[model samples]
Target: MAKYANGHLPARDRFAHWRELLSGTHAPMTLSSERADDFLARQHVVALGEVTVWPAVFPPVTFRRTRELIRRSDPESYHLTLMLRGSGIADWRHRTLRTSPGTFHTSDSSRPVEIRSWAERGRIMMIGVEVPKAVLPLPRRLADRAVGLPVPDDQGVGALLSHTLRRLVRDLPEYRLADGPRLGEVVAGLTATVLGQVTDGESALPPHVHRETTALRVRAFVEQHLGDPDLSPALIAAAHHISTSYLHRVFRAEDVTVGTLIRQRRLRRARAELADPRWDGVPIQTIAARWCFTGAQFSRSFRTAYDMTPGEYRGLRGGDGPGV
Candidate 1:
């Protein structure tokens, strides 16, 4: 991971420095900002193989890639932007899109595009990923349809992709440089999945990408319905319109069964609530039920996992009092 900041630079050189950095990190582009004279910005970049993830905050600015710039040098890649806290307008291929928080925008390096963004209150914050077009598993024609399109990141595959990007950025510090290629594969796979969903091109993805995407979707579903007692492999399969056996096969690569994954997540959630002081007044059984665990079963599982019963663990964590 690499970090860049312009706060220490001379005020007159801040925006210019920012422009140069952007050109190197992303593709060559002309940047203009009304606050150029005193632009304040910081960027964190993570290079995962051929794919690069950049999380940045900067003053309101307009970035444009002209035809001449494309002619001079084009990475032949697609740039995806996930807006975290900002509003922006993008113009590409004669199409215009207005984007806000929790939305996504895409542009092609081989094409001319213009994006003007402004902050809601503070600096505009967003995460951008540069994906080589050839690296995506989707067909060229289908993937091209997603370029210059603005989509919401709050639903379906988009939500999963958004979560993955944010988690990667947040946990980058914990990853070793040697993990780049593997991490790159994950990001690229999700990018393909998102583009496939957007362009109705899922049928074209390779088997491996399909399996990984399905597993990701299943994990997301499990997280959403963890509190439901009826959550099981059969229900999960039915929700995704796949057979139970197929669901098992999807998770085989993960080295854990679906049932185990659900149980582990539930136990983790229960443990967190038990240790939180705010839940001190809540009965242990009630807390257990909240996470779909019965009283006896909860105690046994908690003891097995943490080597302590729920009451003991709670007391050790400074809860108000222990519970049976």
Candidate 2:
């Protein structure tokens, strides 16, 4: 992983360093800022096989990929920019689109484009992937449709991709070189599904890919909604637009039922809290309620799952995982 930022530097040199950093991370582009102080930004990037996962923060600036610039320095890559903060407008492939937090858009380096983050645009945070054009297995037509198009990251494949990318960025430093291939599979699978769905070509994805990838999405949804007591197999299936039977069929491959998975997850979270020093003074009932458990029911499940009561567990292990 690589990290870059300008701090404790003269205002005049900040913009210069920012430009150099941007060009080094991405393809060279025309960058400018009207603010005398420019903007403080930081970038953290990791290369996982052919995919590059980058998370960054920046202030308002205007960036343009003019025809001349593209012709002279195109990288022949596509960047899927997931907006984490603020908003901006991108003019690419004859389209002007507005993007906000929790949404993403693709930037094709081969094409001329203009993106503006105005003075009033506020701070920005985003995660983007750099995938070489030649290595992207997605169909050209489908890929083109997603270029410069705003893709929703709040649900479905988009949500899965969003979560996976953020997690990868957070955990990148801990990964080994041999894990690159596995990471590549994750990036490709989620990227393909998101693109296919956005372009109305979801049928083009093979059955195994769609099923396995959607299974991950199901898991993501479960983790995200675990706090809701109403979370159930039927609701989970509905959220992903699959039937309850289909949900069970796929989950069977994991050797666990939906109810079992939910229970285990809730129990695990409750256990974490019980062991956490920060929650040391918190009532056992409150911790149970946080994970949708209650009273004796919570204690019984806690004992059954861990062979000890919540109070005993907290007294014993204090903040840790599984082994407790």
Over 4 Å off, model 1:
120-122, 318-320
Could you tell me how far off, in angstroms, the CA of residue 140 lies in candidate 2 after the best superposition?
1.8
Q: Write candidate 1's Cα lDDT for 1-324 as tens digits.
A: 889999999999999999999998889999998898899999998999999999999989999999999999898988889999989899985788898887788888988989999885968999999989989778888789888676679988888889988999988879999999888888888888888888888888999998998999999999999999999999999999999999999899989999999999999999998888888999999999999989999999999988999999899867875497
TM-score attained by model 2: 0.80
- RMSD in Å for all candidates: 1.7, 4.2
Give candidate 2 misplaced runs (Cα > 4 Å).
Answer: 8-11, 36-39, 119-122, 170-181, 227-235, 252-257, 276-309, 317-324
* Reference-based TM-score of each model: 0.94, 0.80
How good is model 1 by TM-score? 0.94
lDDT per residue (tens digit) for residues 202-232 in model 2: 7876676776786787788788899999999
In the predicted model 2, the residue pairs found to clash are: 275-319
lDDT of 1 at 226: 98
